[model samples]
Target: MEIAVCRAADVALLDECIGSPGAVSSHARRFARQGEGGGTYLVAWIDGRPVGHAEVIWDGCAAPEVRAALPGCPELNGLGVWPPELRSRGIGGALIRRAEELAREYGRTVLGLGVAADNPRAADLYARLGYRRLTDYVDRWSYEDRDGVIRECVDPCTFLTKELPSGSLDVKRT
Candidate 1:
């Protein structure tokens, strides 16, 4: 599988293949954000199909607290793997490694991400990827759905960061 910055066409396919209308709108917005230099929206593909995704926020995180606390650290945001059955096949890990590689390319020494407090599984993934807890924060963000309606979200999250100077993703797969 190859991981690369998502394009508008890829976002359209991602939306149709794995998302709802709202998600389509969100993905489109992410695509726009990428164009504006806000972040790098990454998509992983297998056999010409999109399978996984992750975003690296070049400026910082959406959470205000995290931004203030970890200045200059790029965020690994909105990570996901499509088609639940396809999970645990290393797609997600590949997305993460790609994100880390981008961070290194940008001269960033640290990369951070937030795992929802309720999702220990994702937290474990981050831990195994060399991320350690930094703090807890309420993740808040809003987005415009397909119908042009704005939606809000608030989730409890544990912020984690990893030093990206030099590390190999050789942690044993469970």
Candidate 2:
């Protein structure tokens, strides 16, 4: 299995893996905006097929309250491993480690992320990966559904954080 930053050519494969063309485009746009105020999108591949995805946002883009609480922390967002059968195969963990590596590259010491409050399994996974719950947060956002109708989402989430090991901070813009 190979885990790396998503490139232009991997977009369609990501869409197929996640079963959502819209999501693939959304992540691609985020990646395009990297260094211009966005983040890195990573894809995990097995046998040349995409199996998981995640993004590391330099800006937390959280609510003002949450932002104030987590000053200087970049967020690991939009993490997913697809096709039910692919769960527990370490793809998700590898994607997360890639995000941490990118965070370290940006000279960041603390990495933050929000997990859905109702998702205990994911929360457990994050905990095992060294992320400790910092605070409760709510994410309010809107997006277009498959039918092209805009829908609002208000997710009750828990903010978690982990400290990266100190190293030669290499600020690579990829």
Candidate 3:
């Protein structure tokens, strides 16, 4: 598979990939187009078709809460892979490795990410990549439907931080 930065044209495809039932959330359009403080985004193409993707953001500031929990620099957020089929194929790890590369380019010494607590697979993947658990918090929000009826949802967010080396961090299934 070939991996490359996602372009605006890939939004629809990425949306399709990330919006599948098993995913925690689907916000592909935001990453596909990018905004100020854009971090890094990549897509894995298999047989010339987009099959997997990862999106991330860097604000140059580690969240105060995350910093209080661990020693690290630079806030990283929104890293995810698309398509349930690509879960264990190393696509997510590669995307993170690329993000670390960008972090170093920005003169950062540490990188961090937030994963939902329910996602043990992602937590294990990050651990194997040398990311140590820094802190855990709950993300609670409300969503409104067409009628303005709001629904509440709560999810545990685990923040993991890692010091980057010169090479890609190796990740393994746990």
Candidate 4:
């Protein structure tokens, strides 16, 4: 699999394959086409097909509490893999590793990410990638679904932060 920053032309195919699990279909269009934010979407492709994706939020943590706690620490958010069978095959981890590299390129020393409190598998994955829990908080957000209906999400999350090393591109896993 190859990880690359998403291009505008890739959005439609990405959506057709991934279908936005967290009401983030808009984001694929946003970053991939509009380039509205400081961050970008890193896409995982295999055999010329988009398989996974994650966002590098250069501005830092999206959660207010996490932002206040770790100011200016860019975040890796909205990670997902396409086709349930493709999960657990290191796609998510590779996207995260590429995000870290992008953060370093931006001269950032640390990166932060939030994991839903109930998802132990993800927490374990982040831990193996060298992220340590900093605090827990209610992650609240609202989004407009495909039907244009406003949805409220109030998830309890554990915010984690990792110090990106200046050297070595290998992602640590244990």
Candidate 5:
């Protein structure tokens, strides 16, 4: 398997892998802005097919209130492996390892993210990868679409962070 930086073309493929239009659009924007310091996006490919994807973000100085309440750290924004079929085959772990490598390369000493508190599997995966829960918090936000219907969604998010070993990645911290 090969882990490589994602290009704009990979956005569609990634959306297919995750099976969500919202996730696809969000990630598409992230990939497009990777070159501008939004963060890095990568995909794990097996036999020329993408099997997993990861995203690492550094919010620079615009740290949102949600992120500021805890601590300012490299944020592992999104990670998704293709559904049921390839899960538990270690693809997810391999993708995470790549994310950690990139995080280190970006010169970030610590990484953090908000995960759904109800998802034990995801929480366990992060824990196994050295991430520790820093706070229990719920993020609430509302949005309106073209149809003018306002939808409110609350995510039970937990903030987790992991410190990188010194010199683990080649980049220098900013």
Candidate 6:
């Protein structure tokens, strides 16, 4: 298995993993628009097949309240491991660790992520990984569906944060 940052050449493989060509194109565009201090996508591959992904957003997009509570923390968003059978294989954890590495590369000392209030399983996993709830937040965003129709979403979530140890970029994955 290989975990690495996604590049332009990985679009088709990402599309295959995500099962949405439009979404892949959108991600590709976002990756291209990223500047020197911007964010990028990370993908996990097994046997040359993409299986998981996450986004390391340098410009944290947390709500104002959450942002004020934990300033200067980059966000790890859109983390997913494809197909039900792939769960518990550590792909998600690996992707998250990669996000932390990317955050460290950006000179950030903290990382943040939002979990749906109802998702205890994910919240538990985050807690076990040392993330603590900072505050409640609402995630407002929009995206185009596979049919090119735009949809808006507002999720009630809990903002969680983890302080990264300085100079710990070389921390090994468990």
The estimated TM-scores of all candidates read 0.89, 0.88, 0.72, 0.88, 0.79, 0.88
User: What lDDT does candidate 1 reach at residue 159?
Assistant: 90
**All candidates: CA RMSD in angstroms?**
3.3, 3.5, 5.0, 3.0, 4.4, 2.3
Clashing residue pairs in all predictions, respectively, total: 0, 0, 0, 0, 0, 0
What is the C-alpha lDDT profile of model 2 across 88-118, one tens digit per residue? 9888888888788878777889898898988
Show model 4 residue runs off by greater than 4 Å. 21-24, 29-34, 167-174
Candidate 1 at 113: error in angstroms? Answer: 0.3
Error of 4 at 40 (Å): 1.5
- Of models 1 and 2, which has the larger TM-score? 1
The digit string of per-residue lDDT tens for model 3 on 118-156 reads 888888988899998777866665555445566677777
Q: Can you give the lDDT of residue 106 in candidate 2?
A: 79
The TM-score, computed over Cα atoms with residue i paired to residue i, of candidate 3 is 0.72
In order, candidate lDDTs are 0.83, 0.79, 0.64, 0.82, 0.71, 0.79
Name the best candidate (by lDDT): 1
Best by TM-score: 1
- Looking at model 6, residue 131 earns an lDDT score of 93
Clash pairs for candidate 5: none
lDDT ranking, high to low: 1, 4, 2, 6, 5, 3
- lDDT at residue 132 of model 1 (Cα atoms): 94
Which of candidates 3 and 6 reaches a greater TM-score?
6
* lDDT tens readout by residue for model 4, 89-166: 999988988888888778889988899988999999999999998888888877778677888889999999999888
- In Å, residue 50's CA in model 2 sits off its true spot by 0.7
Residues 105-173, candidate 1: write the lDDT tens digits: 788899999999899888888889899988889998877776778889899998999987655544232
lDDT, residue 112, model 4:
87
| Candidate 2 TM-score, C-alpha based | 0.88
Alpha-carbon deviation at 127 in model 4, angstroms: 0.8
